[model samples]
Target: MIQRISHFFTAIVHRILPDPLIFAILLTVVTFVLAFGLTPTQPAELVVLWGAGFWNLLAFSMQMALILVTGHALASSPLVKRMLVALASSARTPGQAVMLVAFVGAVACAINWGFGLVLGAMLSREVARRVKGTDYRLLVACAYMGFLTWHGGLSGSVPLVAATRGNPMEKTIGLIPVSHTIFTGYNAFITFALIVLLPILARLMMPRPEDVVSVDPRLLEEPPTVERTLSPDATFAERLEESRALAILVALVCAAYLIIRTIEKGFVLDIDTVNLMFLAAGMILHKTPMGYARAIGTAAKGASGIMIQFPFYAGIQALMDHSGLAGVITRWFVDVANVHTFPLLAFLSSAVINFAVPSGGGHWVVQGPFVMPAAKALGADLGKSAMAIAYGEAWTNMAQPFWALPALAIAGLGVRDIMGYCVTALLFSGLVFVAGMYLF
Candidate 1:
């Protein structure tokens, strides 16, 4: 009877939400209610809930603009096709192929996660075709391995640090001394190393083909137009180029963010002022309601989990803050830990949360308050602590189901296949996590 109830709830979750975002949100709310009461003793404190709700909307709206544009730009490229082909040609074994796909997925995600999602989805399909006798599952897994690890890469984490700029905590948590340049370069190097090494590792753990069924050969066949045609009327390339309208919209939004950031530093707008300004900016900049509406819709589709979960986390922190649980938790962890353990915990927490709550921004929203205070109290490498959070969020991204949906859809594979490949990717990721713990 209990098992039946559990299955029933799971079925409902899959039906209504059909994604991790809602799940994250529901879990957060449940945890918050369990941890705190239905109401705070001071009704005025409810303002925190309002503040968190706005933060969720604003942050997610911004993320949608970024992801949509990046996805369109990266997906339309012929280079993505070439990269997929090159990967297919290079790998000898099923495992090797999976690693290559994952590496590429990570690269795509690092460069731009929005792009990573679309690119991985499209490329995984191509790989499925090439591995004539292999199950599409391996390719799907490869895509997610890359999809999941992306937060640790440059594009996602650096922006967060940059957002904080020269504030006290930002300065103290000097994870990337050179800021964006160093962060991207370091992440790129890590991405490259993973690309090279992951395939070799996959080759060792690859399961026999007898256990997995092969896909249809028709799926592998390249279209005649792919090889043959150029048209004067309107080339395929032109159609592809036109699709970049949304991408341009997104780029402009990011540019606006940078511009606002400059103004913010020059004038020192308070958080509330900044929020209002951005809200106004979004309203003005989007112009047509449909464009902004589309961006929001897309974001809502992708980031509902982030939207719901972040506030719950905020509430959790608020409970801790108001009730003194956070202080107690911090003191306990600090008292028990040595310096070596702190970094390890930072990495572990990051990995665990990344899997459960995959968005970097959302994770940071909750983690920043808790981790920041802990870092100050514990005397851990503050910069490294920040990076650890960033890194942990990124490392587990390689396996997170939150990111697997797109890849699975594109590749015509199941989650099981992707999870299988992730098993191998996680082993190496663990090693990297340990190294980061010690090195930083």
Candidate 2:
């Protein structure tokens, strides 16, 4: 029955889902129509908002692209590849492979979203190389399923921002400490539940034997690096290009900076820090600066999807925020919610807004004004209220192709390839999120 359900969704997704760029374009049109019809903003104003905001995410777009490039380079290191191979070898059967990748993805994601996204994709490919007959798409989706817990984790933008001083909502709710937000009973329940169950759900969603789409090992295999043997009389520039000492010097600088920074401030796993760590690790592990550079060049090819599509999303977010469509949509949910129901409703509202904003920090920026005020008025738990919005954003991402871009790029797959299983994950995980809201 589970397999059949998986097959059903897979069939539908494969038939309907276009390239994610097309999906983004279609979403842009949908947002325009909704804003024009539902809000008081003028059509001319909407176009200006889109254009003005088109470049808004340029810094963010680079960060995302680097997340893919750096993470992939780190994973392509020889030591990391051997480690991945060892981990993959632990799972002999297809079922074990799915479960292992799912669990690993969740844990890594919980630690850091960027790490989880790339690690899961790389690990799944390695697992596929070893565990023949595992459904390759399902492995990638299972890895993505780890994302369900990201917004509740340490690097979660919503909770982290809420805990910081002078945040947008700080005036209203005061600073919500991590103890009250990320480390709370409810957040733990939700995160723990997903971490524990997502793998099982992934295993259950495996396609039937005949329906399985396994990848060829040759396609998944990395090509050998063809560095020529250097003569004893090699030129100074050539020697410097392959210098392990130079790579180690740069790696040490990165490590020293990160360690000192962490000691001075706090252990923050924001994108910049994560990317630096990946680059540093990759440099050291590759044993030479040029080898790491070659790895980065190879990995960067997968990142074109992220580089090209993010501006459209930025435009969409700008339109939704500037045209007041996001607030209008949030108000609809807020109007129906009371103290007891605000958490769930806020979660639902954030889920709706996610399609438009499709960002964690962006969700907080768009929904925080509307949500925090309503929560205070309705006497809802402020921490829970904030996390509810985070949960919704994270939950609905299973259905959205925005965040899936990084994982898909690394997996060498299309948006449709893993989305069918992701839909199933969204359903099962939705129950956990809803139940946690009710209980905590």
Candidate 3:
């Protein structure tokens, strides 16, 4: 039955899902229409909003691109590749391969989303290379299913924000600690459930042997080493480029900085730090500045989609936030919700709003003000309410391809290749999110 449902959704997505760029464009149109109709914002203002907000994510776009480049470089390093290969070799069958990829992706993303995205893609590629007869598309989708656990994990933005001082909701709900938000009994159930069950779900979704879409072994070949023998009398400039000493020195410096940062802020991670860590590690593992640089050059081609498509989603986020449409949507859910249902409804509303604002930090900003005050008034669990919003954002990402760009770029697959399976995951995981919010 699970396989049948997976097959059904896969077929539907293949038939209906357009290119991710087109999907983003279509989402923009839908957001425009919804915001215009639902809010008092006029057409002219909406136009300015869209155009003005289009460039808002330029910095974020750069970070994402770096994640692709740096992460690819790191994964391509001999040490990392060997590690991934060892893990991939553990799975003897396609089912085990799919399950392993899902579990690794979940654990990685739960630790840090940026790290998770790149590792998941790289691991999937390694798994595909070693696991013959595995469905390549299903492997990628299973990797992405691991993303659902992120918002409940240590690095989850909504929970982190709720726990922080002077957040927008700080005055209303005060500071809800991580113990209440991320470390709670209910959250544990949800995160553990997804971590444990999603792999099983992915295993179930595996296509039959004959039906499997196997990738070419040549395509999965490890990235070539950048190191090459230099002439005895190589020029100083050329030597500097390949200088292993320089790479080691730089990596050590970065290591010290990161250690200091960890000491100051515990384990808090953001995009820039993650990128730097990957960059430093890649440089060290590759054994030279030039080697890591060459690896980055090869990996950069994958970032083209991220560079072109993020602006469209940024515009949608602006339209959703500035137009008051996101707030209005949340209000609708809050209006219909009582104390018992507030968290569930908040999760649902965040799930809807996530289509426009597909970002973790962005979701908290858009949904926090409304959900926090309402939870306070209704005597609801503020920590759970915040988590509900986070869960919603993470849950719907399986349907929203906004976050999938990194994984797809690295895996060398199109959105359609993995989306059908992701849609299946989206449907199946909805039960976990709902149960987490209301039951525990």
Per-model TM-score versus the true fold: 0.61, 0.98, 0.97
Residue-level lDDT of model 1, residues 1-440, one tens digit each, is: 32233234334533454344445456555434533453333434544543454344445444443443334223323554566667667766566566667677767776656556656666666666665554465566556666544555545543455356563356445433535432544445555666566555544444555645566565444422212222668766655443435545655675577578778775433223333343333333443334334434433333333344444444444443454333344344444556668766766666665543466665555465666567667776555666666777767765455555554544444444455456456766677656645643
How displaced is residue 314 in candidate 2, in Å?
Answer: 0.5
lDDT per residue (tens digit) for residues 63-173 in model 3:
999999999988888888899999999999898999999999999988998899889899999999887889999998988889999999878998888878878878767
Ranking of models by TM-score:
2, 3, 1
Clashing pairs in 2: none
Local distance difference test values of all predictions, in order: 0.52, 0.90, 0.90
Model 3 Cα shift for residue 73 (angstroms): 0.5
lDDT of 2 by residue, 149-205 (tens): 899998899999988888898887788888988998888998999999988888889
Pick by lDDT: 1 or 2, better one: 2
